[model samples]
Structures are given as C-alpha cells and as structure tokens.
Target: MTRKLTSQDAEALAVSALVYVANDPVLLPRFLALTGIEAPAIRQAAREPGFLAGVLRFILAHEPTLTAFAEHAGVAPAAVGEALKALPTGDDRYLAST
Candidate 1:
C-alpha cells in the first residue's frame, strides 16, 4: 500500500528539488535569478518559511525540469503537486477581493 504523503515528506522532496537545482549549471542560475537569492546565501534562505514551497513552485513551473526531477527521484510527476499541498502556503488560496 502507498503511504500517505505528509509535510515531512513534502519537505524532503523540496529539499531534493533544491539540491537538484543547485547542482545543475543551467537551472541554478535561473533559480537564483528568479528567487533573487545569492548562491552563497542558499543555506540560510532554505531555513526561511515558504522557501521550500517556492522551490517546489519553481520546479512545477517548468515541465522539463519537473519531468527530469520526478524521473530522477523515482516519483510520479503528479506527486510533486501533491507534495506541494503538504507544505505551508501550498494551497495558494487567494483572498477574495472586496
């Protein structure tokens, strides 16, 4: 039976995604550029709230990246989206406008 995905699992996936991006010459620059996070400050930035969610978001935004990551991680591509929901701010609920 498949185990339920928890916040901890999602966090681990996000961490792996972060590492995947960090190690990629092309993806690392794009991630840093988009996140406005310095390469040197990545460890510190990872500790911040919603950072992991952002990492997932980054991976999700790109189909090739997501596919590569999912294949490499041995998870279904859809699992990344499921894992996102397990993390804080992953719901992406927009406040109703007045």
Candidate 2:
C-alpha cells in the first residue's frame, strides 16, 4: 500500500532528489538560481520540515538541470550538496507519492 505523505517524507524526497541532481554536474546551477536559496539557507532549510517540500515542488515543476536548479534555487552548488547530504534518505517514498 502507498503511504501517506508527511512533511518529513516530502523533505526527504527533496533531499534525495537534490542529492541525486547535485551529483549530476548539469542541473546543479539551475536549482540554485531558481530558489535564491544559498548554502546557509539550504542547510538551515534542511532542519526545517516544510521548506524542503516547497523547494522540491519548485524544482519538480521546473525540471531544471543541476546548474539550472542551483541558479533557480539561488544556492551555491556546494551548499546544495551539503544540504542534500544532511537530509534523510529513507523517506524517498514521497517521489512516488507525488
């Protein structure tokens, strides 16, 4: 059965996707610029529950590359990587739920 999506789950999905995309070497920049979220912000957001969900929503809607996602998110590539690392990986169910 499909599990209901919690805020935490969404954040995990965002983190997982972000981590996966950040490693792509193509979508990193785009993700940052679109969100206007820097490394500090990314790190801070990771601690917050809903923030990552919003960021992920924007990213999924835009489907930007790593560079584009970075640019779009306004976060540095390194920051994105750091944030992605901080996030949990087990909650990836959000991807299919969404």
Candidate 3:
C-alpha cells in the first residue's frame, strides 16, 4: 500500500531536498541554473514564499530526481505535491501535481 504524507512531512521532504541538492555535485548545477540562485543565496532564497515548493517542483519535473530525493528522504514520491498544498504562500499558490 502507498502511504500519504502530512503537510509537515512534505515540508521535511522539501528541506531534505535542499540538503540533497547542496551536497550533490550534479544536481547542484541544475538547481543553480534553474533558479538562478548561487550557493550563497540559497539560505536567503529559501526563506522566500513558495521557494520550498519550487524546489519540490524542480525535482518533480524530472522523474529520476524525484525518485532519488524520495528514496533519500524516505517519503513516497507522491507526497511532494501534498506538501506544496499545505504550505500556504498567502496568495502565491504552489501547485505540485494536484
């Protein structure tokens, strides 16, 4: 049976993905290119609304990245979308898959 993730769980996954991207040699470059965020700016950018969900969405855009992060985070791949929904950007919507 597949497990569902709570909002908190999704938040955890997004944070974990940030960590994962930072340590990764390959994915790191992709993140920087896509987000136009340098390594030094990650901390500050993370504080912005929908940033976490954007990270999750980036991973979701690529199936392999999504699978890898899900495995490392110990969460069902589908959970990422749920997490985005839970994170209220106060008007800025974060739609992952649903």
Candidate 4:
C-alpha cells in the first residue's frame, strides 16, 4: 500500500531537494537567484517555511535537475511532482496540492 504522506515527508523531500541543489553546479545559482538567498546563508535560509518546498519546486522547474535528482534520490521523476502536491506551503498558488 502507498503510504499516506505527512508534513514531515514533504519536508524531507524539500530538504533532499535543497541538498541536491546545493551540490549541483548549475542548479545552485538558480536556487540563489530564485530564493534571493545568498550562498553564505543557505543553512539559515533552509530553515524558512516553504523554503524547502521551493527547493523541490526549483528542481521540478528544471527537467535536467529533476531527472538528476530523481536518479540520485532513487525515486521516479514523477514522484517529485507528487511530493510537491503532497506538501503544503500555505501559499495556495505555489502549494501544488489541491
């Protein structure tokens, strides 16, 4: 049976995505620009609400990054999209969840 998703699971996905972004040579810049977060403050920025989700969204936004992360995370690329929908960020527009 598929496990019911929880907030923690979403957070985990976001965190993983963030880590993926950090290590990526290309995606990292996009993350900084999109997030308006400086490289020095990544750890602090990661603590912000929706920040993790944004990381996932960033990955989802790019086909290459998404594919790479999916391969590294051992999840299907579609799972990232599903995770985005499962996670709630209070911002209805970007929440992805219905």
Query: Would you estimate the TM-scores of all the predictions?
Result: 0.89, 0.46, 0.80, 0.80
Model 2: weakest 10-residue lDDT segment is 85-94
lDDT of 3 by residue, 3-36 (tens): 6566677677789888998899999999999899
Going through the candidates in the order shown, the clash numbers are 0, 38, 0, 0
Candidate 1, residues 7-98, lDDT tens digits: the string is 89999999999999999999999999999999999999999878999999999999999999999889999989988888877875522456
lDDT digits (tens) for residues 1-98 of candidate 2: 53445444445556666675567565556657776677556677667654565555545455344456566555554444444334444236333443
On TM-score, the candidate that comes out on top is 1
Off by over 4 Å in 4: 90-98
Residue 91: error of model 1 in Å? 1.6
The better-scoring model by lDDT among 2 and 3 is 3
What does candidate 4's lDDT look like per residue over 9-94, in tens digits? 76777788888878878888878988788999999877776777677888888798889899998888887877776665724655
Q: Evaluate model 2: give its TM-score.
A: 0.46
Candidate 3, which segments miss by more than 4 Å at Cα?
A: 1-5, 89-98
Model 1 misplaced stretches (Cα beyond 4 Å): 1-3, 92-98
Better of 2 and 4 by lDDT: 4
Stretches of candidate 2 above 4 Å error? 63-98
